[model samples]
Target: MSSDRQPIPPTRPTGHQIIAPGHTFATVSDKISSIVLTRRTPLYWFIPFLIASALLMVFLVAVTALLVRGVGLWGIKVPVMWAWAITNFVWWIGIGHAGTLISAILLLLRQSWRNSINRFAEAMTLFAVACAGMFPLLHLGRPWLFYWLFPYPNTMNVQPQFRSPLVWDVFAVSTYATVSALFWYVGLIPDLATLRDRARNRGARIIYGILAMGWRGAASHWQKYETASLLLAGLATPLVLSVHTVVSFDFTIAILPGWHSTIFPPYFVAGAIYSGFAMVLVLAIPLRAMYGLQDLITMRHLDNMAKVMLATGEIVAYSYIFEAFISWYSGDKYEMFAMWNRMTGPYAVTYWTLIFCNLVFPQILWVKKIRTNVVWLFIVSVDVLVGMWLERYVIIVVSLHRDFLPSSWGIFHPTIWDVATYVGTLGLFFFLFFLFIRGLPMISIFEVRTLLPQAEVAEVEQ
Candidate 1:
């Protein structure tokens, strides 16, 4: 290893400095690229990969059984038609929100701290979206006919109902996926070129060379890369808010008691961001430790992420209060009953657990010590993820189980298959993420290099 590429001493960053002192352009590039290039595949990497792969098999088996035995294998009965699947769908979608917010919005704001973590965060977004997308298709009964949801010309002349928010999700998610993939790939071109040039193996160089598209680090290439990145960032900025808002419409447009509320849009978006940041911390904390990248992903990054979680958690808490208030103030007996049932009914445990998880536990982040502690941050992040999932469960299952007419009311229980399927998706997510870490630069090499003192001087001189 080159002397310049040596790891920085493990030291906690003081104040809000993004990167530690003593890093140069070469150090930044070499340090990040080495993870994907020259480093030996550590034993720890395979341990989780094997576990995730085992879970992935569970997902495949569950999916195959669903296809063979039908959606009846799930707990979806008459009144409780939407259960674990929809809850998992919404939760996964919400988890994806932080990536776009961190990568696009922060980039536009010129926040340099995002450079270290945005690559993996963006990958998380794509992977989460991929996981979320699977449920709607499986929920369609005929999983093979999912393309019918699209407004394509066909012989049957079947068109998706334009008024239905489910149909709206078809377009919204597809658009979000396309734009996110483009943005992610566009960002990777420079890094791909870096890998291509540095790889010792012939096959690795060829594969990366194809992905790099002949990027030569020219002045003109940099200008075009900057312009394209800015334009994509501009386009993606609105998607951070719009996609989840459209998702909320799936419930809001309904006349069902808990479902029909104006506040759902903003409420859902805030919750999405809240859960999304928690996931970033969950992924970041372990990754930094395992790779000995404390200097690169400093305490400053963890602090900022915790602060974001705190802010969004507060918004979600207020939304909960306001939701209850509106139900009482409007004197809507059905809405009131929905809220009452969530508190006192059979599923009340989930509701209260979510309350403590999303609202109560996260309040500890207000303390600077907790925000900077990696172990506490990981615990809080896991708590938030659970809280967010239960939040969806309360919103979907609890609300649907007991309608105004008692005759039609029914309890929704998640069968073994439902648990299997949900757990399977978790496996799928981690499996893809593990593959990503091994194959690509998890941090943006060129972007982080720009944060070096010499690069700043070069920019000024130019």
Candidate 2:
């Protein structure tokens, strides 16, 4: 009875309380601006950037080698044609989706929590897509003729054949990258203006002013800004669904047993969000600690993102299970054998790793405490991100290394070149992100300030 004494009142969080209390417009502005302006650069930032730049150099070296030697330097061969390059392309593209999902989709749904995170997420989208777009272009036999994929009228009257799924991907990815860049830039305008007005030095003021594009922050400007963002979100929501659907078509349109599934479009979309959100958490954990913005990005934000990962991860697991079931249920010998191969073939280690990392490990998140715990959540995010990469590898390589004919069967082993290229892209992504954190406001300062209660209308006028 004593232990069961009267319960305390349950409190609810209001819209204004989405941000921490006592954070005024000036406070939010100062907190975010100080990182880029007043505070000296952190050593951790320099160390990582230096390492990333070194890897970027390696990437340049590897690309030069590939161009000079042709695509023969990599381990890609007859049966294992789609190897590490395509896998990296898909993984990067999938990782890019979380940014749009957070910036556009969640905005459409009116989630206030996203206000603090969408800026960097949108930036991540643009950078990830840039990296993803590189693979297909570099894999071209004549890297110099990469522009042939575009729909421009040639002097010789040549044009890109829109009938190809590869062509569809060209449109899908380019469009996605362009919209992501514009969306990201538009979001930055107000914040850039804040930086512009607050700059103590003429150099800082001029740099930020150009980026701000003469934003006056008038009421009419706010109205137009809201309208444009809403319309862009509408345009982007379907691109998220269609881009990956086109990616899945690259496999599904094939005659191969493992590749010709009808369920691939939705499955790919779900997998994209799953991996994308994992990358978000992976970045969020480190950034939150490094920036000392724990109050701004609390456990509540982490908990909510963990829930999205859990939901999407389950969809991915279901897709995997359904693929196997359909293969068995159809009684197609090649499909059944392909499913068996995934479970027990030479690449069984990879297959089971995908299952354990994507399916099994995420199950721990069903416990609230573990999902919210910093260490556990970070580990889970890392596991899922790696698992998604393995999932892409298994899907592409395993499917190709053993197709319909036993005579054509072979193995795929990534060469030093493959590893170097992937590592190089990693460095490039971090390099761009480092520059972003150093120069621009990583968090949306104005949006965060909106989450705190504003002064009364009369008080503002006075």
Candidate 3:
């Protein structure tokens, strides 16, 4: 008997069939343009411009002081050479990781929620990297001859040692910054086109139009854009992972008891993500409120990000425990002493503060109530960032203060220039972010449109 079944034919598009209308995409484009271009009042432009200008001036003054006076102005001295500057460098670099992880990794994973925050997150990565890069240059006593770090044949007889972690860090950070900027700019083209069309003035229209490269929302262009984005995401994922690992190598490869450890790479990666997610939350909450993007950046986005923070926080906590266990297991007196010193030594306050902020506070996010509340999340995020900074401080200061030579051991302190430079970097990071928000679309309009329920259903039906 013939089976009562029909063969399923391949679904094919008909040339005459009407293409689905993209109202949701158009609406998101309008909303994004409104945020970037339309200021309700002069304060929209004035506040950011004023704040950024002030911060930039401070940064310039601080740098000039650093250049004129020299590294002697900072607190760095014998035995405790690495101080706030290096700590800030590592912290900022770690902060940069979150943006790439959110934008590139989550994009490749097809996590739709990433659309709400990826643009600003990517911007944060670029700015953070820029800030991070400044420290190493300034940390060098002779800032003018900093090119010695690079391998130039014939010009300098000494080539950069491939085995050195600092050398690896230079390559890794430069590559990450370059690739992240390219990925961010490539992703911005469509949104820039949206801005081009929405511009009210000739100057605005001309600038945005040029940046948009005459993009007309053509299907072919979208196809190529999507492909390029995926390839970049693929490249960035490994780059993100490797960059942090290389950074860890700077400490781990050293013979210092606390610094040399196999577990550092993962631990550092987790801490980076933990702090990075906290930063994203800190920035996102204020931005969503300020830009009237509550609907676009929904509670769902916060909840999802909270989960990421919680997961990474747990990893960091475990890393702390693992470091303890490894110290004990290795039966190395110096390692054990270093671990003990971190807990009950002179800088125990910093160490415990790290434990409380990075590990303890983040546990509160496990509760749905706390995670969903934007205010609480923002508070926790700040706490986490503080804790992360302290963690770095503990790692650098505590370990180095009482190293192999008991006679040479001493406490490290930040001088006026150190304080100014640290504070100035924050100003610079914010200055860049503020300018980015005012001048460019901070959210991905095209990606957000794809997240609308109606759009999802439409795609499913198709």
lDDT of 3 by residue, 183-231 (tens): 9999899888888989998899999999999999898777677778888
Model 1 off-target regions past 4 Å? 1-16, 458-462
Give the winner by lDDT: 1
Model 2 lDDT tens row, 127-199: 8998898888888857799888898877989888788899999889999999899999999999999999988
Cα-lDDT of candidate 1: 0.91
Superior candidate under lDDT, 1 versus 3: 1
lDDT of 1 by residue, 1-462 (tens): 235853321111122357788888788888888998999999889999999999999999999999999999999998999899999999999999999998899888777788889999999999999999989888889999888888888899778899899898989999999999999999999999999999999999999999999999998777677878888888998987999999999999988899999999999999999999999999999999998889889998999999999999999999999998999897989999999999999999999999999989899999999999999999999999999999999999999999889999998878999999999999999999999999999988887776665553222454
Which has the greatest TM-score? 1
Supply candidate 2's per-residue lDDT for 199.
86
Estimate the TM-score for candidate 3: 0.92
How many collisions between residues are there in candidate 2?
0
Error of 3 at 101 (Å): 0.9
True-vs-predicted CA distance for residue 97, candidate 1, Å:
0.7
Where does model 3 exceed 4 Å of error?
A: 1-23, 41-49, 454-462
lDDT of 2: 0.88
